[model samples]
Target: MKKHQATAFLLLLLAALVCFFAGREFLTMHEEEAVYPSPHLTIKKRLSDYFPGLKNSPGDSSVYIFEGQKMGGTLLILGGTHPNEPAGFITAVLLVENLEVTQGKVIIVPRANNSGFMHSDPQEGNPQRYSLSTPGGPRWFRYGSRLTNPIHQWPDSVLYVNPAGQKLSGTESRNLNRSYPGRKHGKLTEKIAYAIMQVIDNEKADLAVDLHEAAPEYPVINAIVFHENSAELAAVTLMTLQMEGVDIRLEASPPNLRGLSHREWGDFAKTRAVLLETANTSHGRLKGRPSATLIINGKDKNYMKAAQLGLLFVPFDEDGISLKQRVSRHLASLRALVSGLHELHPDLCIQLDNLPNPIEVQKVGIGPYLTPSK
Candidate 1:
């Protein structure tokens, strides 16, 4: 009943209340984001189905398949390899929600790294989620980490070596991009990669595309990195994209690089592999305060200054690169790749029906193309 005792009790109660609300918000990130796929979706499977070891693990992710009436080659589109890149993730979602295949099969894994989506990277000041305005309502999606959540796979070794025997930063052990052609009994990330290789093998995918984003200052921004096996396909795609007024460049996957999708998929799975990168300010080091606005708008005064200093590879202006623009670039790149694929290999032609027109998507924004959350 003393005055100091009453004060202590009140302070403790206040702290408990704050923890309750904060903990609740943290827990909500584990809830699945509602994705409305188009009627053309023929089959939906889990990553675990391809690799039983991933069952009940955080690495398991969804796999959406769209097949045409006639048989043809299969194409695998992977996005969210690093969950922090929204454009890549959004493009995959757009295709699944709006596309129909009429000549071949398309397999999309929108969240290739499901564990990454469960949490955001630490000390980044990054927002937990971002929203897009759909005609039906506002649809929210996670803005997650680039690596697997340490909660699911912890204790980073002093050094990490991939299946291909290349050393990387210990933290990269959790990076899905660095764990390709994965191991069956390896860590969680490796298991996810192994499962993807299984899909490529079982589905007999003719081509595999990994969508990504990079900091504006990064040299590889707005680039198409192709394995040597896909050199011709990428060359044709570059011309096609350029003719469409999309500024793009091509980078050959280094022969020495190991554990990357573009490299391993071609060598191990026999699938032609390529990766597309768009510039993302929010994903950069010089970005201003990280928030949902920064993730969506991609405008940072710091980046503009950096661009003025010629520090950025991609153009950065007061206009800033909007999410819609980045998504449009990705969609156009995919469209071009598919076009080039059919051109080079008649037997592996993949046709897309109702693929969102990139120009229209840019003009009207991504909201119109995205199906409302059910």
Candidate 2:
């Protein structure tokens, strides 16, 4: 009897110890990464500023505004909509750190779905954090889930019907990208989506760009998705990118695909909406042993094999697609988009300076562009 009691006590103690360490690691996700804005940053507001319903909620996120000396048009850049896609979020971070607007306003929401950053996807062997070396020091950012944390919004419905009335799988209820023009009193993810639309509407944005990434095997990899309203602009941008030797494909947003930012933002907010996608091997099913190194360096022998088998969308080789290359693609596309927008409407031209060169960024890496942590 005494031996049984001793064994039970030992088991309990081991369990408590395990919980203690795991809990601490989990809570660290709440600590956000540091982002240093440029001299042109005019205002920093919370998403709640646009939607009062989001006040004091985990769904609330930061909005950085940079108004140029000469007022012209407003462009909104949304990143981290799917927290697992590091390239999108990192590209936004680069803009905040180094961009200088000279003719119009630029609004950036680095973490579009704040709650998504609080936890990684369950049952996926994903790293909780990844670090990058900056000029000042090493900086760490969260490696988060694609959906909102269940703690902030509980009990997914068997079928999620978005505001657009599109039926999606239950887990999609937590997907911010699928909750466009969201409800004032809906789920947390929906509320976050609603706040973004509020930002677009209230700000009277001329152009809104959402950045994202997909698995290497995804058909839409290395593509630009644009709304019908932005067809001409997209075509011009595509031509410019091709001229620069950046072989990019353009995908028009399907009118029937409801709830997507590219579709709904243009329809409801009257903004020229566009979305960019890049290849991310770490997020693919064929990936081997997900790790921070894979997220950063993006090299995998398995992916190489897949590419050789002609199963992958983007060209892949032993060199792989590093985060720097992915970020460079996004930055290059944005530059082309802005130039195209300017060409289309001269009066609404938004002149930006000190934008990182894609080739330079690819060669020097992401560290130099990132601000040093103070």
Candidate 3:
């Protein structure tokens, strides 16, 4: 009888130890990563500044503004809408750290879904964070979930009706992308969405871009999704991107898609809404084991095999698309988009300086453009 008790106690102790260490590792994700914005940054604000209800809330994301000495139109860049898509988030960070607008104002939200970064997608086995080589040292960024952390807003409903009255699974309630022109007294995710809309209206934004990524198997993998209002701008940008050697397609925002940024941002606000997507093997279903290396290097044998079988929409060879390549596509499209905007709205020409060169970025990798963390 004594032996049995001893054995049980030992097992309990081992379980407790495992829980303790696992809990500690999980807690570290809550500590947000630091970002150093552009030297030309005019001011820094928070989502709460636009919506006081978001103050001190997890949804209160940081907003960076860079204004040129000369007056012109405004552009808003939203990143980290889906934290699992690192390319979008990293592109926003690069712009924040290296961009300089010389004619118009630019606003950036590097982490649009602040609560999303506090957690990773459950059961996908994604790493909590990944590292990139910088001139000074390694800089780390978190890989967050596609939805808001349940901790921030718990007890999800069985069905979710977004601000636009689109019915979605309750799980999508946490998806910031699905929450459009959010509700003032809605859930945490909704509040974040609402705050973003406020920025568009309050700042008189002329163009708004949301950065994102998709699996190679996805049909919309390497595409520019634009609202009806932005059709002309997207067409011009698509041609320019092709000229720059970037194979991209244009996907019009479906009118029935009620709550997405490209759809709702256009219907609700005067700003032209657009979203950019790049292929990421790390985010694909066929990806082998999820790890920091897979997220950074983006090489996956499974994807290559699938591509050979004609399963993927984008070409996936042994030289799997690296983070550098994905980011370069985004930058190229951005430059084209901005130029297109100038052509469409002559008065709203947003001349930018110090934007990363897409071709050069693809050649050297993402490290050089980023400022090393202290």
Candidate 4:
């Protein structure tokens, strides 16, 4: 009896230690990340402003607006849809700090899925934060998960039936992309999507672009996916990018692929929507040891081997896909897309200035474009 009591006490003590550590990690994940915006920002609004139901919820996020004295078309840019893709978030931050619109208006949501930034994907071994050295000081940004944080909406079902009636794995229930044209009273991710849609409708945006990155091995690497309504703009943008010596492929959004941003946002908002993707080594499955260094430097030996094996869609060698290159591609694509829109509708032109061009940013790097915090 004494032996059994002693053994039970030890098990209880071990359980308590495990709980303690787990609770600490959970709390740490809740900490909010910050970004310094440019002085040119006209107004900053919250996602809850459009969807009152999401006020003060984990899904609530910021919307930065840069309006000019001249009246013209409105364009919406989204980043951090999938937080694991650092380039998307970083490029958005870079734009928030550097962009100054002179005609029409530009609305940016740097962290579209706010909850996703609060946690890392389970068992992925990804770094929680990555830092960059700027002229002012070292700036740190959170490395977040691919989907909405489970803590905000838990107990995934065996299967997820999206609002559009598409079926996916239970895990996709947490994917914000799969919850588009969202319901006002839907789950956490859907509520976020709904708020975004509200922003588009309320602002009467002329064009919407979603930024993202994929593993080199993914076939969609270095490509632009556009809705049918945006096909002409996509073609023009692709041709312009090619003319500028930037290799980019254009893919049409499959009508059957339900619930995607390119598909649903266009359908619901009647606005042209496009999604741009870049190659990122850190986000790839064949990446080497995951670390903050890898996220910044973007070098991975395994990806190099995969490239040699012809398994990667993008070129990978000793010079891995650096964060600078990825941001350059995204900013270039944004420029091309906006230019194409101006050509298509002269009345609805969104003119932007003071944005770092791809070639310039590639040469000078993202540090100079980042405004130091006061």
RMSD of each: 1.9, 1.3, 1.7, 1.8
> Over the full model, what C-alpha lDDT does candidate 1 score relative to the true structure?
0.94
Better of 1 and 3 by lDDT: 1
Q: What is the lDDT of residue 294 in candidate 3?
A: 91
Stretches of candidate 4 exceeding 4 Å from the true structure:
1-22
lDDT of 4 at 166: 94
Taking the tens digit of each residue's C-alpha lDDT, what string does model 4 give over 301-367? 8988988899999888898888999999999999999999999898888888888888988888887
**For model 1, what is the error of residue 106's alpha carbon versus the real structure, in angstroms, after optimal superposition?**
0.1
Clashes of 1: 0
Cα miss at 163, model 4 (Å)?
Answer: 0.9
Q: Candidate 2 lDDT, tens digit per residue, 243-293?
A: 999989999999988999999999999899999999998999999999999
Candidate 1, 1-374: lDDT as tens digits = 99999999999999999999999998887877888999999999999999999998989999999999987778999999999999999999999999899989999999999999999888998998999999999999999999999999988898999998899989999999999889999999999999999999999999999999999988998999999999999999999999999999999999899999999999999899999999998999998899999988888999999989999999889989999999999999999998999899888889899999999988999999998867
Q: lDDT per model, in order?
A: 0.94, 0.94, 0.93, 0.90
Using TM-score as the measure, what is the rank order of every candidate, best first? Answer: 2, 3, 1, 4
Candidate 1 lDDT score at position 152: 92
Q: For candidate 3, give the lDDT.
A: 0.93
Report the C-alpha displacement of residue 15, candidate 3, in angstroms. 5.2
Which residue ranges in model 1 land beyond 4 Å of their true spot?
A: 1-19
TM-score computed on alpha carbons, candidate 4: 0.95
